[model samples]
Each structure stands twice: as C-alpha cells, then as structure tokens.
Target: MSIEAGKPAGLRERKKLETRIALGWAAIRLTVERGFDAVRVEDIAAEAGVSPRTFNNYFSSKAEAVAARHLDRARMIAEELRARPASEPLWEAVANAVMARFGLTQETRGAGTSDQQWITGLRLMMTEPALQGEFMKAGALAEFELAAAVAERTGTDVERDLYPRLVAGAVWAAITVVTDHWLHADPPVAIVPLLRDALHQLAAGLPVP
Candidate 1:
C-alpha cells in the first residue's frame, strides 16, 4: 500500500506523497486556468517545480495527475475499512470507513487544500473529455480496491462473489450522487449529511416510501 493506516509515513514515502500531491494540484490548477487542451504535462511539471521525468514517474498523463486525489482517497477509505472493528456490522463499518476519509467537516475541508478548489476541479472534470475518462478510470480502480477490502472483511471472493462488488458499487454510486448533487446544488448544501443519509438508506435496504 502506498500509505499505511495508523502509521506515520517514512521520510521517503512522505516525499513521494508530497511530490504526487504537488503535481496533481498543479495539473488541476493549470487546467483550470488554461483550457484542458492548452495545459501540457510539461507545464504541470514546471508548475509543481519538478522535471517532466519526475512527473512521468508519478502519472502517465495530466488528466490522471489531476484525478489522483480521488484514487488516493479511495485507497485510504479501503485501508480505513480494513482497520475497522471486526465485530462491527458491514454497513456500519463501510459508512465509518468512508466518513473517516471523506467527511467534509471544517478540519477535513482545510486539510491540504480548500473545499472550493476541490469543488471547482471536480466540476471541471465533468466537462473535460480527457479528464472525464481519467475520472472514470480512477473510479473503477477505487471500486476494485474497495471490493477487495470488503471481500477480505467478509471472507468472500472479490472476483467470484457478488456481495463485495455490490457493496463497493453501491458505495461508489453514493459518492458519485452526493458529489454531483453538491456540485450543482443551487444553494450548495453540505455533502457529509447527504453522504450519511445515502449510506443509511442503502444500509436500510432502500425501502419504498
């Protein structure tokens, strides 16, 4: 795993994480400032204060770099799920794991970057062709890791069993819905409550009203 739960990152790992984050933020910022087609990988690297070689080592394309945080956060959620108490119910564990990483409270909102920046970057992804593809790819990778973690917790086969995949898909769908709603919300409602409600509805089997 790139980052371990409950453990401090080593200096080397910390440096790598910093570099990845810098390149990612640079990619998004540049893409936002210029049109996506106008922002080259070289420009992203330059903005991040790294060479093109260093940028290539971390990401294959500018789109991937811009979408890196989504992948990273999903991985963190999987790790958080694995670290949850074994005795907890699966849905509860899943919800807690998601919130641990994605809850948009004051502390979490200010960590590393501002909430407005994240929201703007995500809205941009919806319209950018290359970035939309990369965002979907990132989502698929996140679903795969999340399914594996759920499978591990439930002693199910990630490839053969439907349960883990279903759970992962549901979680990902919920995230997508919440983010989309939050992005286009006429008045801009908070996301955490929506996330919690969505997960709760899923946990409750989505009964008819």
Candidate 2:
C-alpha cells in the first residue's frame, strides 16, 4: 500500500531500520575495540540486544553487518538528492545531500576534533585486510543509489545510460580518495569541507591535472 503524503514510517519499518542501525554500530564498536577477527556474529547480535536469528534477518555475515552502514547512508543520500530542487547544480546538490545524512555542513565536521569513534570505525573498515572484500561490498551496495541519483540529475535512465554510470563512478572515486586521506591525516582534518571541496572540484572538471 502506498503511504499518503506526510505519513510517518509504519512501526514495523521503523523498528527494522533501527535494528539494522543498531546492529551495524554494534559490529563497528566491537570490531574496533577487539579487532575484526576477534568479533563474531553472535557477539554483534548480543551487543545490539537481539538474538542471532534476528541478526541473520539483517545481514548474512559479520562483514555485511560492518558494511551495512554505508549502504544505509547511501540510500538516505540518494533520497535526499532526489528531493533537492531540480534547479540546483548537480555537484552541489549531491554533496549537500550526502553531508545532510551525516549531519555535516560545509563549515563543520559533525564531530569536531574528537574523531576517534567514527574515524576509528572507518579506518578499521578500510585497513583490515580481512575486511577488504567487505569494504568493496559496502561500496558496491552504494553504487546503485549513486548511479540512480546521477541518472536523475541527467534526466536519463540509469540502466541504459553511460553518463550516469561514468559520473557515479567519478563521484565514488573522489569519495574513496577523500575518505582515505581523512583517515590518514595526522590531526584528523575535517571531512565536511574536504568532501565539499572534492565535489566542487569535480563540478569544475578537475582541471588541475
């Protein structure tokens, strides 16, 4: 059934989303504190205050749980971008939509200088050799959302268009680079500005070859 305008999410949908988020955070926290190989699916389920069976409904493996956050955020960003005024510039709209989901702004990072929690989470996800497949798995999960948003911006069908795929790939490549640089920075540089600037550069054709 279609939800009417202004209708809040139904209880079941809310609960399912919350459970997925809780499980993802639990997986991140556990793996960060104890190392990836040390964590297990049962432990993640327990930390999220759910049973193994409940956890299984959301994710197939520990890797998938760890990677789920990006997928969730990606979907949110896609929706947000879709809602932006069509008159807005493509790169500006996409960047703002993404930062909105993270509670970030062009002038501020969400967490200020205290970056340990999330930076640690991202670093673990990016650096853990065992989780490399999971890292790519996360990126893959976000790919469709990016492609669809790009297609929408270009007034084209994602499934049939090359521009959408090309633009989406470029955006992801920029994001990957920014994320890596942010994780490796000695003082934990603010991500929001970096992300905004990266998008701006892309918007400008990245002329500094």
Candidate 3:
C-alpha cells in the first residue's frame, strides 16, 4: 500500500488507542473518587466522553479498563527497548527504555513531584481489592512483552531460553518494588532515581553493602 493509503489506517489506530487510554484514566479517577465498588462502567464511559457500548468494545470490566493503562505502558517499554542502541548493555538499554516514558510526565509520575490528587487517586486505585487481580493480569502481560523484547535483543529463543524471562521478571520486580516504595515513602522520593538505583543494583549483581 502507498503512504496515502496507509494514513487513514494509522489515524484510525491512533484514535482507538486514545479512546482506550481515556476510558482507562476515567475508570481510575472515578474509582479513586467514589471507591472501586461504587464506580460503574457507564460512569467511566461518560467521563471519557464515550458511550457504554464503546467502553464495552474496549474492556469487559472497570478493573480491566483501569489496568489497560499499565498494559499499554508496558508494551511501549518493550518497543522502546527494541529501539535502544545496539552497543548498550541489555540492562542499560532496558533501564533507559523504561525511564524513557514510564511516569516521566507530571500527570503520571508521583505524589511529590506531580499532582497530589492524581497520585492519591493512583494509590487508592492500586489498593482496591477488585483491582488486584486485574493488576496481576496486567503484570503478566507486561512481563511477556518484555521477555519477547529481551529475547529479540539477545538473540535468544523466547520459547526455550530462560535468560529472557528471568531478565524480564527481574526488571518487572524492580519496577513494582521501587514504584511501591516511591508511592509510600514517608518523605516522598523521586521515582526516577529509585528506579535507576534498582536497575543499577540488579545489573551489578546486588553486591553486599
């Protein structure tokens, strides 16, 4: 197909992604404001400026909507990792890929640096009982994507090799633990430094202090 022919398809895909992201953010905001149990799919759709039927086309449940943001970000990370310089070490590439867009913005980063209300909302959303299972599913999806990227980068078979999956798991764990610490730190800390340190330690074999 020619460039002109592909333009409409690209635009359509972008619009769908934007809609999905809007719905997910709406779900998170509503859940934070009214508690997870009180929020409904219709409310999320309305908040996102879409209809309930449209929301249903994107996500089966409110929890899935909320988790979609994480899944999307993870996929982006995998893509970024794939694009990093070939000369860079795998850990460095992975870290840079993650730090490239993962929560660098004021709207999504942290309570201390960004909007407090949104951070508080995110904290509430993370702890919701109904959302836990969805988050796990999101994590699994994220890990799978990362593993595939790692396998490609290292020229390993993702299906048969253990290295890619292990690296992916470690990276995911670092992301999870560091983000949790940043979220709950007594004196709030910047997420970027914490994430960088976590990756550094992992790359350095977690040497004794």
Q: Which predicted model would earn the best TM-score?
A: 3
| Candidate closest to the true structure, highest lDDT | 1
Residue 187 lDDT, candidate 2, scale 0-100: 82
* Deviating ranges (above 4 Å) for candidate 3: 1-9, 107-114
Q: Write the per-residue lDDT of candidate 3 for residues 69-182, one digit (tens) a residue.
A: 878888878888888989999999998999895873645332344355655766887888779999999999989998999999999988999999999999999999998998
lDDT of 1 by residue, 1-209 (tens): 36865688999999998898788778876776566888999998998899999999999888899888788889989999999999999999999999989944434233555667667755775798888899999999999999999999999999999999999999999999998999888776889899999999999998897
- Pairs that collide in candidate 2 are none
1 or 2, which is superior by lDDT? 1
- Cα deviation at 182, candidate 1, in Å, is 0.7
How many pairs of residues in model 2 come into backbone collision?
0
Give residue 85's lDDT in candidate 1 (0 to 100).
98
**Shift of residue 8 alpha carbon in model 3, Å:** 12
TM-score on alpha carbons, each prediction: 0.85, 0.85, 0.88
Pairs in steric clash, model 3: none
Better of 2 and 3 by lDDT: 3
RMSD to the hidden true structure, all candidates: 3.1, 4.2, 4.2
Q: Considering only N, C-alpha and C atoms within 3 Å, which residue pairs clash in candidate 1?
A: none
